[model samples]
Target: MKPHSLTDRPATLNSRYNRLALVSSPRHLALLNKEDADTLVVICDWLLWQSAVTDGWHCVHFETALIDNHAPDPLDMDIMLRANDWVWLDGVDHTLFHGVSLGRQFCSTAQYIVSAYYRMDLALRKLLSEFSCREVTLYDYWVDRYLVSPDLRHLIVATVARDMGVHFDDQLDPVLPGDPALAAAPSTLGAPPTGWHKLAKQCGLALHGYAMTVMVAVQRRLRPRVNRPLVIANWNMVRSFLQSDPADDCQPMVLAPTLPKTLNLLRRFWSANILPCPYPSVGLTQQEREQIAAMVKVYEAHWSEPAEGLEEAMRRFMRASVLTLDNLLPLARQVKSVQAFLRRYRPSRIVVDGVKSPPLSIFLELGKAQGIPADYIWHSPLAPQNIRFDNLGCESRQEALVERCLSWGKFNDMWLERIGAACSSVRVGNPVLAKYTAMKKSGGGRDVALLLQLVPAFSDVRGLYLSQYEFFVEGVRQLNQLGYKRVIFKMHPSMWREEYYEEIARRFELKVEIRKHGRFEDYVREADLVVGPMVSGAMLEVLASGTPMVAYFLKPSTLDSTYFDGLNVQSDISRLGEAVTNNEFLDPAVVLDLYCDSECGQSPAERFWQALSRSPL
Candidate 1:
């Protein structure tokens, strides 16, 4: 089946696919160099008519000179691609061109939006809502336009962020005074010894992915980037979670990153060379710094609820930062720094585990333009109709989006169908799962593990589990009553620091092992039974491990009806104690059918080679 060209498309196309191809042609990058700006007229016209977003856009041409003073906006790029009233200048603007006066003329027939004023200049944004409706904001386009095309990629624009860019909206902690989790970060500024040569060497390693003189895309000082050299660009904890601890020098291997440890040892396997990614500190303009500082107040209102507010607030912040041009100065500088870092690395292929982050969305798009292949390895199963909310109120019943999506379970039927709808996904099993193996049988242990989700800071509220704080706390109490000696409460990484875990464990007198990091596989493997939230990706890992597991849905929604309606999943936590002690929950075999077929019974390298063979690379 041919993709819809610039002219003709179905009135209704799959939104997920629309998300993949924000711009009609990947060749848009090639046209960027053309001397004539008129070439963009065609592109803009095509975007005005053919783009995926239906809300329509108010297109305005920004001066190219802004690139020097302004930042590269991944979000604004989405707006230009999606709007019907799309505007672009015939030539680059040497002077500022406020789109407000132009918006009134073009939007007479259009709906009202609040954020549109932020679209042009931050100074000009206060003049918004003088015209236009309230149902919309300035723009809400996505930043993953070029993320779908691997063949179009020549570079991999990615990052390895340690902090994960999280900050609380409030100055003071309401629950815990100076929450141990809020410990002051050690100053990293100018912390390294002022040695020019070492800094230069670090620069070379980061910029070129190899030694200074090396021109190849995959040359690292520690290892060579050969046969799909894997460059790990972590937006979250993926790097630490997936990468082998340097202390684990039990086996000598090239690059010494863990993926090749077991599977590659079985055969002369083609594993990627792990590049050393250093955390970079780029300077921010004073204006950019101030704008970012003000975000705390703005976000505090957007996310006022407790039980999972911080995560939702963080998510809201990212979406606003990445999806709207409301404030692009900081984001722009960040992108420039990211691009410079990635270009220095010159990576051939990129590997991502778990879901994509909003902050990284721009990098992935940039990678596609450079022709780098990114392998998105999700932690859990991708439901055909995965729930996505408008705001952070994922638990709020009113927050449900009524838009149509592709029918559920269609992707599982065909091999090519998976991730082919938009982004290219590989079923390499869950990286978190790969770390686990059966620890004998459940009979030897009377322990149970309750894997927690985001709450008290922000609610992920997947399926039936809404209040992760209340649900998991009660879950532990119930499991404890069931005569389980150890109800190991796996702490969420966002919630748990090493010190915080010890404090919570001691303070609550909670007789459970509070793990701060990726020891989930170890605990799940050791536990007699594993119970998780209503809809967690970790379910596949538990099910595949041959562990007796149950999905505890508090509200008993569609997921329970589809996978475990009749099965022994405990929809009622009241019955959890009776069911678990009596061995009445789901058997591993019944849940195995949901596993990504190629991922089952395979190592990451084994499954990766199979995926690469089938990939265009």
Candidate 2:
């Protein structure tokens, strides 16, 4: 059979004609003068646009700037058109102008020509190798615009061309095309593929395809409405989980909530109940209550339940649902609630927030007896934060026991072994990091902000209270020593109680600004650096923003050494000076490795998702 020729092809044959033409915007073309030409060539292949160039086909490369009536006289249209059959190079607004110019230039010359658009620089680099051809032409213009790196641009081009089936002459580069799993592949991060595998086996649990579902369960709470970092992390986990499966039993769900406000947004995505176990006096307003009700309605649609008394409601939800318990209730109450709920729901897993809640003994007993997987959902930094309150009746024994369990060197290993056996821990990134990235790009300025969780240093609450004041004083002193002028301190939402701000000022003898409760990312974005001693998770948020952090570790009496060891805690005050100066210690990849590897387990979100997937209605 004879091969097909361009002349014999139908004027509008869809199979022969390229439906997608990807040209870079004017901004990208300007970058060509600055970037390595070889790199540009490589990018074209990576973008999958190399085939068309090598075939000596008519490919038009246009600059958006030139098409906007910005082309200079004495233009080298021939040099531009040397190899390609057609070329139109324009400046900014070229996308608009190119359409007009193309119509006038090719009006009646060709039988049929469909204009498929792309950016200018992308198109040039894609067709640069075929510059030996003579029929090429160019329209010129110039404009300043930011362009992605040639390497990244190449990958993008290749992906688009691959999807469009137009072979670009560029070699294909590995690109994470909006698939978190491909981005989070073990090879991508240079980590072991079986990292979660080891964790599951250690936990002595079966690998159920529940993690992806659980990710869908709490994706809202874990992510923001716009540009959520946790979404990326969740995507990566979901992709990994799906690929790990040999069968089609589990598929990932993308949770996008159509809510205006942050409060109700979570309900749109998750069926799991989020009991806002705030302090007693922290009452919800009428509007807030109505919003919560609306959210509940949406939540109940997929995971519905009958209304009952508080105890029974907790029991029923715990039994049937994947329980997410915030640590506020007493140890006995918390354990009993979980136990009762588990008996009814027989849930596949549980996530307990707040490190100070239930004792380790209770969790161990529950795990040993019921084979129910459990993990922590930390929301604060691991370092101390300055706060004061009178602990009138809180017990210390439970605190001590919990601290001991967290500190035990073998506890994490054992827990990992147990949990890792059946279900893998999903490594979800912090959502706050995503928020901070947006805030910074907008040029919102707040120099230094501290997120403080206040609690008194009295006998009952002494265990929970570390001397964050000392760390703050030291942090301020160091910042001053390093010649930083302005600093803002954001009090944790819980610290709004009493005169915590006044007390902090009195004790520290420094006029630190007390910021109002708001999105933590705003503070992170505005501030140059974040300082705290005990807010590990919050530090994770800061790290996500690629911000510098100065942490002061005030060793609590009952604190676990293993927890500190796992953290690779940098407690030296001098190190803070170095970190502030170098600004290289706060990379999330480094921090994640330190934290994730500390305990052979998946991320909290990952574990939660795993549980949600296995729980029967």
Candidate 3:
């Protein structure tokens, strides 16, 4: 199937192959046009969306760009809403995989799959709306495979087409050899683990599995002598609950499920007796494995053909799904183990940093089921964003995940009410805010801290033009030009690709210091001014600390920025220096009052611990 040439009439286009060839790279389209393919092209990437405008073939782009003349389609939101609703099968707010509620067992994995599906649906619908024919030709040269698996992609595309009452004549165009110039260019940021890297990962997982098995057995034997409250947290979170005490009595023992090595060091050096709660070493039962095998049929019914036959595609998808499930099995097992732990140990009350984490979420759910009270502390600031509100609303209602929210301040209360997270609230004060307030700013320092966030190229609410690498390199260049003597790059805890950061630094020849460890406030105190993206959670702390900070608003976010209206929110990178130097900031006391509105006499950490101790059963 081929696209009609410019001289060919519309009637000819309707005869055989409809007008579209989906290409992975802009260079691919250039090559196709050079070869006189004369087909209408469709682009899938955000960065490539810009090229479609200038490129010759009247291309249709999936990603909406800043330069797009038309207003965003209202149907885009409708599509998202429909996708969200469809994920919950049979009117149940749960994603089922072979009759098992994957959403209930593994929240993050289900959310990821649903999110990917939604994005794919949006792209397909956007393309179809432009070319509203019942039948269309889609020349598949889309080989940029980093974002999603080919199997899952095929399944999503087929399902969306079926849902929209459309049929596709997929023509498999062989992948063209990449242009050397384009090949070297940074298009996609990350690569999937392969070769020796893959082997090392497998070996590490096996070791962790063995370690978890031993830890679970040891935990059973080392159960607390007397029933007391349990603090489900990491070593750092334990500090918020307990003061520096001489006695390591293991009362309200901390369950640090993440970072066993760190826990070992903390146990040896710290006052608190932090227990390692590794993920349980468990496999699916025979019945469950059979159920997983049945799940392949669902995918088989929906998957579109690639180079392989339908049977081969189904076999590959089945194997992939099973492998994925095997990786996630520990989470399911951990959930069960948590229930058992609650039954046997019978903790009086359970306190968690947040209910979003699997270990903490499981404890929250089980605590409620077993008639035990659970307290939720606001570990980090929750920005009042549209995406977050929808997500919280959906997840909270799906399960009564929250029993009592130990809110940081009035700000948290407002967010809770808005999202309808209908749980009792106690203003326990924010330890993070309290810690920041205690530190005196060492003003007169020449150091500037550039706080980094993990902003991906594609997301449900993403509107950023810059990739993570582009943003960092450009930010450093701007800072370097601004006569900053020493610039410190502070990576977000969640953005743990140190090697990636190092590579970016090396490629750009950036003169900066990288700090991945220690307190965010320590860096804040050391710097004269702090600069970071507006979406960063660290911005809240900077505001609370009354530090001179510039919130870089590169793009529009789903988050309401009315709160930072008076503060420094610079959209233009060129004016960042001006904003930083002038430093006309909001009054620190005002920010503190609004965000950290707690009883002022006691420190937030002390107030938190006291609140936990006196809470009624």
lDDT of 3 at 285: 71
Backbone clashes counted, model 1: 29
Error of 3 at 594 (Å): 3.1
Ranking by TM-score: 3, 1, 2
Question: How big is the positional error of residue 439 in model 2, measured in Å on the Cα after superposition?
Answer: 6.2
Q: Put down candidate 2 lDDT per residue, 585-605, tens digits, no spaces.
A: 444555544543324343333
Top-lDDT candidate index:
3
Instruction: Estimate, for each residue in 480-500, the C-alpha lDDT of model 3 and write its tens digit.
Output: 777778888887654244555
- Candidate models: Cα lDDT each: 0.36, 0.33, 0.52
Clash count list over all predictions:
29, 81, 0
Shift in Å, residue 182, candidate 3: 12
TM-score of each: 0.46, 0.34, 0.67
Better model by lDDT, 2 or 3? 3
